[model samples]
Target: MTTVLFVHGTGVRNPGYEETFKLIEKAVHLERPDVKVERCLWGDKLGTKLNAQGASIPLYDSTLALDEEEEDYSIVLWQQLYNNPLYELQVLSLKPGDETAGNPFGEKPGDELNSRVERLNPSTELQAKLDVAGIAEVFEPARDTVIQSEAYHQALQNASEELGEYRDAIARAIVAQAMLDCEQQEKHPPILTDAELRDEVVKLLSLALGEAELGIGDWVVKPLSQLAQPIGTFYLKRRRGIITQSVSPTPCDILLYQGRGDRIRDFIRAKIEQAEPPVVLLAHSLGGIACVDLLVQQALPPVELLITAGSQAPFFYEINALYSLEYGEPLPDYFPSWLNIYDLRDFLSYIGANVFPNKVQDVLVDSKQPFPRSHGAYWTNKAVWKAIIPRLP
Candidate 1:
């Protein structure tokens, strides 16, 4: 039986697996029950554990010592895991410590005689002069007393808090690492070269920057047109320049775009290799840009079909003219059988204009309603699905 593996993108939790699995199962069973369905849980636990270990010393010395970027990334990654539907049922709860003042060490006085001797014992010299070393030893104060003391209690609380913080930090780190690893896998796939991955990154970054520029007007612009245009223009131009320079084709010593793009490309390539073949890649928003990078820059294997809905493709063209400008080398061709879905009103989808190169075709779905917030609903829209299902094998 053919197998289907679904890989979720960022800002989701492990627990979200069940709901997603059910959705896929329902869709597949109705379509093709003979095909087997399996979920490969890329848990953040291990990654979290590793992250915790690495940050343990830093956390111990000063929580402030933690890298701000790393910490922020870790928190975002963990929150995603927490929000995931797969492991929602598997959430772990902390247990309250036993309230009883019972001895945790299981140590007690030796006997009645020993207890009496301890009570009657005088100075150390008198005990030694009496040649009662053995008895004195039996009557010695219990070391376990400190274990049950208030000082020890406070110490334990501090330790527990520290341990919990470390665990949380590590879990977030693991999720981040897993995300990075997943991206690399997608880029390299099972059979591809680093050079291809590098190239794809440049292309995808160009596309992403364009999308960001187009969408900025909706979020960044204020009602007053006078103030909005200048601010928006400045932001757009500056970011556009950054994106263009990053992808410049030169033999310069350090290629910033190559590094960033390579990281994302390599991650995607790795994800592709570990999973079954003939997969359908469903990417949304910025994820779509990454997918494009994987396909165009990394030279990934063609899947059953590529579906991108409410994608940022249109914005890439609006934000800058660089993508449209004729360059020395020809633009790369990608996803010949690709399906690009967009909502006419969704600003993020960049749907209302001609953005893609002449080679690529865009399929506009009515979205059953006007554009805008309906962008994300494109995947589930009956009309959108109607267009996409026919294309899928």
Candidate 2:
């Protein structure tokens, strides 16, 4: 029997990533039922800022950096994650049939949510004690508690106060990091549409604003933008877990301990050692990086195979931060059999062919969605299944 360990990258996992693991297992089992699929949940090991018991944080933020230059302007890399607030406050505030204000798609200046509240009809048993109005009365205080909380006020105030500076930091981070000087950025910088600017302003005002840094040439700048973008998002998603979500001095064990993630590699190594041999390690996103780091940098026993999908190792290589390799060094001659696959739509996923040369087999899949959506699409996609089955023990 072959054991395949599925590793995850950045983002909050819904249902603690059980859905993800199951999806991958089903995808793989469709062809090979005897093979076993397991998940290495490292998202919580770092910790989270989300608190499900209190209220859902109305948190949504993404950052952009210049990627390539086009005709009149450069294209900025959009780093987006969908971590919505638990409940819809606006919907709860409105009557059951009220129409919301604006059309997001239409070319209108004003916009408001056009959704109406959907109240459930009371059951006969429940109606014995309370009428519809009585039920509404019972729930009204919960809504008030959410809106009137001191924490909510802090969140609102913090976002509003830092809005302007975060916007400046967004532009500055991109300009400084693009390897382009200030004058060059002014001349051919990426032109953002009104909607883009409006959205970025909120992101700049987001909880993640200060943690991301813009790279200025060879120098990296922090305190301007949060450089720990991935880790911050992961923390947000894992906020529902009790042990992981507690307010702490260290919000992210992964990013704060140095972006190389040695601690995670140690965990991965331990998992690998415990798994039955003839184990085929399957890693996604950051998990891929940790697995590679373990084998190359640490003295871990090699598994049967190393398969990675939607990984960011190629980008890490450019920074000379991949712990195993030296400056300009190709993949090590002793590196295990590795199969790397990626989706063209997930810009975060990079091609390793040029970097590792012939040492790595790179496969590209067409995930119709763009950007981060494509990043996790590999879990159930048929293309990913085909790639995994052939390499299994």
Candidate 3:
């Protein structure tokens, strides 16, 4: 007998997941009546804990917070002008599931912009070169040790703390430049991404702080970069009002899992162990991301075919949301085979192949629906079952 374990995704509270699972379960039963269907139930537990606290993930797009800039600071005016909450608003205006505008490689607009920003910021440029060139092949020998006036690393840390203020000033400067460039070209000024904003800001800081000898990509120049990731997860959920202050037992735990081996690992592990061999692990959205993290860990239960739909694993990886991958390493070769399904109409569902490369296969289907509907529509789509039936043991 094969066990099919269902894992759920983000922003789902009291989702009545069993009904959704039953849809997939019914399909599986047609193929193998004897197969056992089980749910990992991680969301239920996590949600219960969160709702008890009357908590919701804090919204993070504090472009307005930039307003508190020191007035005497020369760039204060720019900070007010460039702080962009509009990026999220603009993104929301896009029709759900509409095929994005032309980019043959199927990259999102942000990915394309990163390439342009790379020219301005060598940190990203070097990282890109290393990603394709293969990090193992790169070599740069250290110079002979020289005495230092203080702990070199700690000194770098101090410089980094001061760079935070400079980064804010720099972001405003970039926005101003973007505005000017568009005016000259007779086009509307576009929203600046954190990187494009930072790249431009770094250039400005380089000129402004020339006497301080700060350069882009310095260890001291890192812009609390890790903390920047969760805002995407939080902003997406907060905008959806997935959970409320008068919260029910249902919790959206992706925000919680952001910094943390992932929050659901232990629960999933226990359930998988009792399941029949050659198990089929099916997951949706953030649940799928959790499954990937669980499977990729050392010495975990084996899954014959891993199924995912409407997941953010690829998107999360791209945004550096996966802490395990912050350093840009590939999933282990032992990583389970993944058949990831995404509907373009579901803004949250992103492609995984380019991110996971050889380990994941991408399947596209038309949901032809809007956001909440497109994300949840997978269970009813026969195309999803067709992909699953062949993979079942």
Candidate 4:
């Protein structure tokens, strides 16, 4: 059976896969039942795994860890004050002649017993105590040789780089802890009063932790398999005729593949090996770049047809000099039957419009008409399929 692999774009969450996959799958089944479809899933777990393996991932630092630490300190301080009831009474019960008594408008008789005695003197012994706790020694240098040696500077640089990795570890830990807390709390029966608010707070904390964990880094450079699995469920659904597919590879990632087209070509080659019939690559945005790169590297099977919508092929050629990258191996004098469908408004696809330097047949589908959404609504456009159906061998 013919195998169609659907790759999705970026910024997608798990829920998005569910909805989009269903649409693509339904469309595929209606059009070709014998064809096997697969959706690729790439999310938090995949992103994390890639980062752990030394891939550079983008992460967000919200200072949540620091804020949590500060809040915990404040809570402990407040609890200590409440526990010592005598501390409050000692300040309020001062009277004339008492050792701890204070003059109505002057320094107290016993500075040690007076809670507010520090407020009475601008430069007092109590102030020195606070300063010694490091609050006033912020500029002090470390006594260790490691802090002053040339090796120290090198270590500092290393530390700076490791901070990024450290924060990522902390974020992941927080997410895991939050998940465990949520599960534990759910086991207890509901308490009707203030517990409702507490429950809501717990839920919000869990979500925040998850966001921090997932935001640890960008996972694009990771292995395609890592990125593929999370998206697999969607592709699997598409294979089963449940959802529509969309692919948007990052610009940087596409650039990498353009230089070494073998990455994607190898992936497709593996899939072709798995199934007997040829594979159809439905690509969008930068995904088209990857497809072009693949075409240049190897003699791909007689691809039934190559379909690209809102693609960025022309930009690669136009700015090839600036990017310092090769346009793929030259296309054959007679290229594969190709359909390049694009809307005028989608500035992304327009980059390749009106130009087919490679001699590939370019069929522009005028989606300027008012029905389907312009940039993203490629697959939904009936005109798209009209152009595609005849070309499919």
Give each model a TM-score. 0.38, 0.50, 0.50, 0.41
Q: Which candidate number maximizes lDDT?
A: 3
Residue 112's lDDT within candidate 3 is: 29
Ranked by TM-score from best down, the candidates are 2, 3, 4, 1
How should the candidates be ordered by lDDT, best one leading?
3, 2, 4, 1
Higher-TM-score candidate of 3 and 4 = 3
**lDDT of candidate 4 over 1-393, digit per residue (tens):** 666655443322432344445555656777777777665443322211122432343332211111112122212211222222121122222211333334546643323212221122313442343232212221111112112334223322222211332223222222223322332343111111112222233233223322222222222113222322232232222321111122222443455455654545556556545654566666666556556655645556645556677777666755662132355534554345556777663456744433456455565665432111234556545566677655554
lDDT of 1: 0.37
lDDT of 1 by residue, 190-217 (tens): 1011112222222332222122111111
Candidate 3 at residue 259, lDDT?
45
Predicted structure 3, TM vs. truth: 0.50
- CA error at residue 182 for candidate 1, angstroms: 30
C-alpha lDDT (0 to 100) for residue 132 of candidate 2? 16
lDDT of 2 by residue, 125-236 (tens): 4333223112223323332343353432332222222133322333232222221231123322111111233233223322132332322211112211332334334423
**Angstrom error at residue 16, model 3:** 1.8
Better of 3 and 4 by lDDT: 3
Which candidate do you rate higher for TM-score, 1 or 4?
4
Q: List the residue pairs that clash in candidate 3.
A: 9-287, 97-344, 97-345
lDDT of 4: 0.40
Scored against the true structure, residue 361 in model 2 reaches a CA lDDT of 87
Compose the digit string of candidate 3's lDDT tens values, residues 1-393. Answer: 888998876433435465566666777898778888887777655543444453455544322111111122122222223333122112222313224344546554333222332333335544343232222121111000101112221222222223333333333333344443433443321122122333333354334332223232322122223223332232234432333432222123666666443457777777888787768889887778778777767545458778999888788788887655652688877677889999875666889888777878899986433333456667766677788888777
The local lDDT score (0 to 100) that residue 301 gets in candidate 3 is 48
